[model samples]
Target: MNDDVRNIVLGMAAAGLSAALGWLARTCLWNRRLRRKQAFFGLPDNSESVLVVNRDAGSPDLAVHRYDVFALLELSALIKECGANADVITQDAARQGFGERTEFCVGGPGSNRRMAAHMRAMLPGMRVNVDSEPGPDRLAFQIGSERYRLEKGVGEYVVLARLTTGQPGRARPVFLFCGQTAITNQAAARYLYRHHERLARKHGNSTFVLLLKVVNSQAYGPDVTELVADVTRAAQAPLPTTAPARSSHRAP
Candidate 1:
C-alpha cells in the first residue's frame, strides 16, 4: 500500500480504539465508583430520592411543594403560635424572618430511619402530623399510629414535640425534622452540625441536624394561631376520644 494510504488507515484505527476505551472507562470504572458513593452516603436506591430529586432546588425567594418551601412556611407559622424566642427543631426551615430553634435531619449519605427512630424516642408525644390535604386545616393521627400524611401543593409544618411537663433530656428538647424541608432556613450552620452523628447513624450518607433557637415574631401570616391551636388540641385528646377527621391547616 502507498505510504499515505497506510498512514490514513493507521490514524483511523487509533481513533476508533480511543473511543472504545473511553466508553469502557466511563461505563465500567466510573459506574462502580458512583455505586460505592451511593452506598457510602446511604442514599435511596429508588429513582425518586436518588435521581429524580433536584438537589439544587433552593432560591432566594419562594418555595416549592416538593422542595424546602413548604417546610419553611410551616415552621414560620409554628413560631408565630409558639411565641418568638422559643427554640424549635426543624429539618429545613432555617433562615428568613422566622428564626429556627433546632433541627434533626435524615436522608442522603449517613442519614437513615434510625435518625427518625431517635427523634421518635426522644419526643413521642410530639408526633403531630398536620394534614393540609382537605380544606380547613385539620389534625390527623392518634397515638399508636406510626405513619402520617401531608398534602401536596399545600404548605404546612409538623413538629414532633414532647408534651411532658418537664424539660426534655439534654439542655433542650431536640426537635427532629426531615424531608425536603431545609430550603428557607438556609443559614443554620450551628444547628446543622450539632447532632450530625445521630443523622449519620440513621442514614448511610452524610446527615445533618440543626439546633436553632426559636424566636417570637410576626413573621408568619394570620392563620397560624388557629392552626397551632387546632393541632395542639387534637394531639392532647385521647386516642379513641374522637374519630380522626380531615381538616385544612391553611388555605392557598
Candidate 2:
C-alpha cells in the first residue's frame, strides 16, 4: 500500500480502537454503578421485592392517593433499573415479616395501618399524630420537645427510614415512607431514590430514620426537599409509657 493509504488505514484502526475502549469503560462503569445500587437497595439482580402501597384509613372505597401512586411509579422504575422485581401489594394485604424480600412501605399511620402497627411495635418513642385532622392546631409529629404540623401548601414533612431487624437470619431491608401528605410521600421517595448513594455512604445498609421537609410543595411539586433531622435514635427507642408526665401520646 502507498504511504497515504497506509496512514488512512492506521488512523481508522486507531479511531475504532479508541471507540471500543471508550465503550468498554462506559459499560464497566455502568455495571459497577448498578451493582452498588442493587446492594444499597438490598435487592440482588433479578431478585424479587415488595412494594407496599397504602390506602386512606377513612376512605370508603379504599383508594390510594394519586401522589402516592406517582411515588410508586417512580419507585417501580428505580427497582426495574436495579434489575429487581417488586411485587406490589396494598398495606392491608401485606403480611408480616416481609418474607425474605426488601420491602418498601409507603404511607403514614393514617394511610397505612401496617405502618401504624410497625410504629407501635418498632418505633414507640416517637410521637406521631397522623390520624388526626391535619392542621396547625393538631400535632403532626412530635420528637421530644420539637413538634411539626402540616401546613399543606406552605410546608410539610415526611419520615424516610431504612429499617433493619435485629433478627438472626433476616438479611432484607424495610424502607418506610411516612409522610404528612401524599405530596410529601412522593418527595420522600424521590429523595431516597436520588440520594441513596449518599445515604448508603453515611448510614450504610443499617437502620436510618430521617425527617424530610418539603417546602412550598404546591409550587414545586415533589422536587423540592430538605433533610430536617436524623431521628434514628429517638425513633427506634422505646417511650416511657408508665408516666404521662409531658407529651401527649396519641394512638395510631
Candidate with the greatest lDDT versus the true structure: 2
| Residues 1-252, model 1: lDDT tens digits | 999999999999999999999999889986665454333222213311111111222344332333333334444443333233323323243332111122323221112233334435443333333343543323322332222333322443333221222322212222333321332122221222232344335533422222222221125321221112223333333344344444323324
Worst 10 residues of 2 by lDDT: 243-252
How many backbone clashes can be found in candidate 2?
0
Each prediction's number of clashing residue pairs: 41, 0
Cα lDDT tens digits for candidate 2, 160-250:
9887775523578888899878888899999998999899889877888998888888899999898878988888777655533444322
lDDT of 2 at 181: 83
Worst 10-residue lDDT window, candidate 1? 47-56
In order, the Cα lDDT scores of the candidates are 0.33, 0.81
Task: Look at candidate 2 and tell me the lDDT of residue 123.
Answer: 72
lDDT of 2: 0.81
Q: Please list the Cα RMSD from the true structure of every candidate, rounded to 1 decimal place.
A: 18.7, 4.0
